[model samples]
Each structure stands twice: as C-alpha cells, then as structure tokens.
Target: MPSEAPPTDFSVARIHETVLQMLGAGVLPPVVQAGHPVLRQAAALFDGQLNAEELGQLIHLMRSVMRRAPGVGLAAPQLGIPLQVAVLEDEFDVDPEAAAVRGREPLPFFAMLNPHVRPSGTASVAFYEGCLSVNGLQAAVARPENVEVDFTAPDGTRQQRSFSGWQARIVQHETDHLHGILYLDRAELRSLSNNAEYSARWAQPDIGRARQELGFLPG
Candidate 1:
C-alpha cells in the first residue's frame, strides 16, 4: 500500500486562535490577512448608520488597537470591518537626516471617515512599503508625493487637508484599503522581499538603489 500522505497542517487554525486571543484580551479586532474575502470587497460609506456616540466608541477602540500594534496607521478593512474608516498617527523620532530625507514629521492622531483623495501635484516618490494585512513582505511602490483629501473628522466635522511625504504615503495606503486595494497590487513585483530579507538587504530607504538592485522601475 502507498504510504499515508503527510498530515495536513492547520496553520490557518493557528491564525484564528491568535485572533481569538486578541479578542479575548479586549483588544481591537484581529487584523485580517491577505486573501480574506472581506479585505477584497469595497467598504461601505458610513453615512448616518452610527450615531455620534457610537462613532466615538469605534474610533476610540481603533485608536487603542493602532497604538497597541505600534503602527503608523490602521484601516477598518484591516480589522475586518467593511466601513470606510481609518486612524493615523506619527511621531518623527528617526535620525534627523533620515526624517528630513523622508519628510517625516510629528503628526497628531486623527481619524478619517468616508475619505477621498486627489493628487495634489505631479511629483511621485517610490519607497518600500509593508502592510499589517499583508504581513512579512515589502515592496517598492510609487505614489504621488502630495495629495489633498476630503474627509469627515471623528467629531462630525467635514475637513480637507493636504498631506505630503510620509504622511501622504500613509494616507494613501490606508485609504486604498477602503476601496479594496492592496499595496501589493500597486507594487513593483520585482522588488518584493520577505521582511527578513528586506531588513538585511534594503532597510535603508534609497529608492534609486532599490530600483537598481531590485530590477524595479525608477520612481
């Protein structure tokens, strides 16, 4: 008789267990990874479905989870919510030169609901980006350096803001999630690298060098 096939691994079950653990701890919802159906569907508009109090509570929970993840930004889709919402924050604490080079600066925490963005200028920049949903992989993506966004604030106020550099990139990345887009979909596939390989070979943010070494198009 043929040898028995190797036992099937249940890695997805382990992922579900981790998600349950996070939920049990009263933390934010577990991040849904790539290939999840929810991540691929366009998120619905918030409209008036949630009252101010309900919206506030949701934003608070999202903010808490974002801080716990220690990420610069998080989107509703990442948390398995199909609503157009996101939170972002940044404290520019890197080397002064690096900060200047990347246009990194301190950003107060903010929430965006039903956000939409338009390119503010023709200039574009390419940098390696990783996503919480698409864990353990990074790739170079070219995006407009500046964008103007119209969005609703957490307190039920309409706001429009212009963002550039790293902030612009963060906003674009998160907003894409609302529209069922992933950074990997826009990335230069030739530049894809595992997280460990990225740290070892392309940790520094040098777009030109990355293009040259990784066989990607210039920004």
Candidate 2:
C-alpha cells in the first residue's frame, strides 16, 4: 500500500503556527526602523586591542541580532555601535528542481570581520538588495563582480583572499555597511524602476554545485 501525500495547506499552516509560537516565546526582536541614528552612523574599526571577553561579546551580539532578524546580513552600526565589522550568512539556496533530485550539497556558513575590499577585477551590477538596518525596502545596486579583501579572522588571525560573484557582492555590501553606507545609498533606482524594460541581472549562485547536470528549478 502507498501512503498519501501531505496537503500544501496543512504544510503552510504548520509552518505559520511554529513562527507564531516562536514569536510569543520572545525569540525575535523588534526590527529597527530606517533613519535610526545607528543605522545612519558609520561604524568604527575593531580596535585590534579587544580582550578575549570583548571579542566574545561582539560575536554574541551579532549572532543574536542575526538570529532574530530576517535579513541575510548585518553590520555593527545597526547595533548602535560604530565599528568596522559585520556578519552574514548566505541562505538563499532554494532550488525547485532539487525537490525531485536524489541528493544535493549544502552551502557552508561563514562570518567575516574587519574586511577590507579592493576592486581588483571585474565589476557588475546586482539588483534587489535589502538590509537588516533598512527593512521593507530593496534596490538594485552595482558592484564589482570580483574583489580582494584582507581581514583578521574571528580568532584574530590575519588573512587576505579574493572572491567573485555572490561572495564578492556580500563582502562589498558588508564593507559598505562599516563605512556608513546602506544599499539605498548606492542603489540604481532609475535603472531598477525601468528594469523590466532593460534588464541587467546579477547574482551568481551555482559556483560550487556538487552536481552540474541538475537544472534550475522554476520560479
């Protein structure tokens, strides 16, 4: 005998119920609105002189805010402190085709701190960027397709590396956050409004796919 498939309505209802329960439990924080002083202020650099406890506190604060927020990235300024640091997680790996596939690899999680970016290679424009500090808004922005950045690890180890595509964009975006710039500041509002007529897309997601034969899922 075969089992029956679950209904989509039931699935959505269960997810909604879980979210409501979490909200009631105080796992989420009220989103900070636009024009907040912190959101507008430029962050300061990590003094390179923080003790272990101080560094630990910064990390914890960033993690806590990120966990409670819907945005994919956040900066120290959003927390009312101006500091040259930010944290992000790339979680947009939704592929419709993968639903019927046997196996798909997962993307790794990362945290970048005090990152400095240089326009070493190509530049490109990406659209539909939103930020935790600036909620309820998105804009099309132009950025370098590739960049080289230097920074210290969370453990204070110095490191420099080059990145391309989405990685580069994420780094650039966070770097701007440290410099007191929001996505709206660099937004191509005119182009974005007319994007339907003249579309120039950005964002490259499939660089490290475990399988290439799998096609993209329908939107």
74-119: candidate 1 lDDT, tens digit per residue: 8876877667789999874787766787787788899999999999
TM-score for each candidate, following the candidate numbering: 0.85, 0.65
lDDT of each: 0.79, 0.56
Highest lDDT, which number? Answer: 1
Question: Which stretches of candidate 1 lie above 4 Å from their native place?
Answer: 1-25
Q: What tens digits encode model 2's per-residue C-alpha lDDT throughout 21-50?
A: 433454434445668665555555565534
**Every model's Cα RMSD, please?**
9.0, 15.7
lDDT over C-alpha atoms for residue 100 of model 1? 81
The CA lDDT at 2 in model 2 is 18
Which pairs of residues collide in model 2?
Answer: 43-82, 43-83, 44-82, 44-83, 44-84
